[model samples]
Target: MKKLVKLIAILALVSLSQISVAGDPVEKKSEMKMDHAMGTMDESKMMEHLKIRQEEMLKMHDLSNKILAETDPNKKQALKDQQLELIKAEHIQMMSMHHPKMMKMDK
Candidate 1:
């Protein structure tokens, strides 16, 4: 999960650097506007949700690792069940965050 976050940040930086290199004035202006709008939208709503999702995913990953390493069958089953519930909740949360109205507002 940390690696995934790092990769996304790296990609964002690379893309922004490329934008600065563009020579076309109109293209740069439009790109800047688009970037600003996206940043604003993310800061307002999506970024907070993403942070929560990232933390949840990290917890799920840790639970998975614990499940794999456990020797007792009963304990393992309990961990598996917990992980399944976490997954179901995560799915419902992601779906709600991505509703059409929210997405349309971002665009």
Candidate 2:
């Protein structure tokens, strides 16, 4: 019974200390709620970002294709996997431009 009581006391102290050190939870939530203000970004600015990214992705896809053209089957498969990842990143970036994720920062 004494050992159990000591363990409980230690756990309680650890939890309390962590809470004090972590600071405010409300500030964290507000940071997530805050969205990117796209009001300042004009159409041409958006187009420019998109255009540059599209060109880069195209170049990477071409490079990946060239890698897959090799006679080695293993190298071809690896190149294909890398190509998929580049495509996924491109899609994610495209989506983020319209609906950007909020920064996880102190409010």
Candidate 3:
């Protein structure tokens, strides 16, 4: 139990670092929102949910990045609109995963 707890603590720290470093401008904002929302989670229990969400986000971001990187204008616009929902979902997941700190109101 003691060793497991220590391992989770270490992983939580590393995941936080990876999530911070591995993103572009838009993705970076998502990362920041997630980190901010994570707030002060319980290190032990949060590990499972954190790992699952991180994997899911990586897939989502990768798909969005690939679509955005395409050179076609029409398709780009279409993909952008589609991915917009994904971005919102990402923010929601960030909030629900840890804390409600990620959401902000529109002006």
**Candidates' C-alpha lDDT:** 0.51, 0.45, 0.51
Task: Show how many residue pairs clash in every candidate, following the order shown.
Answer: 0, 0, 0
lDDT of 3 by residue, 16-96 (tens): 432322333344334333244556545644674466557655655555566647799888888767655555555554454
- Point to the candidate with the largest TM-score: 1
Q: Give per-model TM-scores.
A: 0.48, 0.41, 0.40
- Model 1 weakest 10-residue run by lDDT: 15-24
Candidate 1 lDDT tens digits, 56-88: 555656776787789999999999887666655
All models, RMSD in angstroms: 14.3, 21.2, 13.2
Choose 2 or 3, whichever is better by lDDT: 3
Kindly list the per-residue Cα lDDT of model 2 for residues 32-67, writing each as its tens digit. 322356445456655654455445545564654466
Model 3 alpha-carbon drift over 4 Å, by segment: 1-44, 92-107
Instruction: For model 1, give the RMSD to the true fold.
Output: 14.3
Task: List pairs with backbone clashes in candidate 1.
Answer: none
Candidate 2 vs. true structure, TM-score: 0.41
Better candidate number, 1 or 2, judged by TM-score: 1
- Could you tell me which 10 consecutive residues in candidate 3 have the lowest summed lDDT? 17-26
